[model samples]
Target: MFISFEGIDGSGKSTQLSLLRDVLEAKGHSVITIREPGATLLSESIREILLSNKQTITSTAELLLFSSARTQLVEMIIEPALRDGKYILCDRYVDSTTAYQGYGRQLNMEHVELCNKIATRGVMPHVTFFIDVAYEQAQQRMQFTPGSAEPDRMERSGREFFERVREGYLAIAKSDPQRFVVIDGHRNREEIHADIVAYL
Candidate 1:
């Protein structure tokens, strides 16, 4: 099964994902974890370009770049792993494109959808977890983290953008309830992990 976790920058999706990966591994499942715009040489290169605040990239260009990375990842890593019967656990996936590019960037959703379909070549997650956390709370967490990593291009996009992205995620989940498992991210780490495991 292909499982994906999604949310805003500081929404704890990564934390929950790590815990779930450990649990699944302990249960004797062959789990392979991957982060979007990464997990392959070419994809990592694309990730650097996407995250670099130093560069000025157009919205359409950004969308295409992300799709390029996704295409590389799916063809080189994701598809092969699935063929080998490994369970894939992804930190983010196509839904992120729809949220960040379509909603956050206010791009055309139809174009974003087309790019995503081309990127993954019809490879869809069996289940997706959308960690629900308020934008202010998430921002506070990022601000308070000790030695926090420098904010990326998207992370620095401001509160209003993230709010739109959050709404986008909720809308996507509402439209596809069967594929999406929405979890409250305000809870403790263990609690969130338990909720995800319940779905698995």
Candidate 2:
């Protein structure tokens, strides 16, 4: 099973993905986890540059840079891992760009979707879990990382933009009930994990 977990920053995707992988593997299932824009070192470098505050680029530049990293990750990390018959869990997927860039940046969805297809070569998750959280709470969680000095670019997106991103997730979830599973991330870890497992 190829599963994708998505939401705005601090929606508990990481915790859930990690937990799910552990549970699935314990059941004798081989599992792989792929984070967006970063997996291998090369792709991680791209992720840093893309999320850095050092560069000044337009929204289109942002979209293209992200796509480039995704293309590399898909070819280098994901494709090979999937061919080995391992189940995959992704932190985020094309739905992120479609929501953030397409709706949040007000870019064209048709254009964005086409670009995603080319970048990922049509590889997508069979089950997408969107951790639902209120915009305010997500922003609040990102405000103070324990050891962090600053927020990453995506994390630093203002509440308004993040709200749009949240809306985008909702829209995607609504669009495909069969494939997309929206969960309330505000619950405790065990509760959320139970919900995800129940879905599977």
Please name the candidate that would achieve the greatest TM-score relative to the true structure.
Answer: 1
- The list of candidate 1 runs beyond 4 A from truth reads none
**Residue 164 shift from truth in candidate 1, angstroms:** 0.6
Clashing pairs in 1: none
Report the C-alpha displacement of residue 29, candidate 1, in angstroms.
1.3
Candidate 1: worst 10 consecutive residues by lDDT? 191-200
TM-score of each: 0.97, 0.94
Question: Positional deviation of 112 in candidate 1, in angstroms?
Answer: 0.4
lDDT of 2 by residue, 28-145 (tens): 9988888987887877888999889887767888888788888888888788888898898989888889888988887888888888999889888889999998877776666654
Report how far off residue 81 is in candidate 1 (Å): 1.0
Tell me the spans in candidate 2 whose CA falls farther than 4 Å from its real position: 143-145
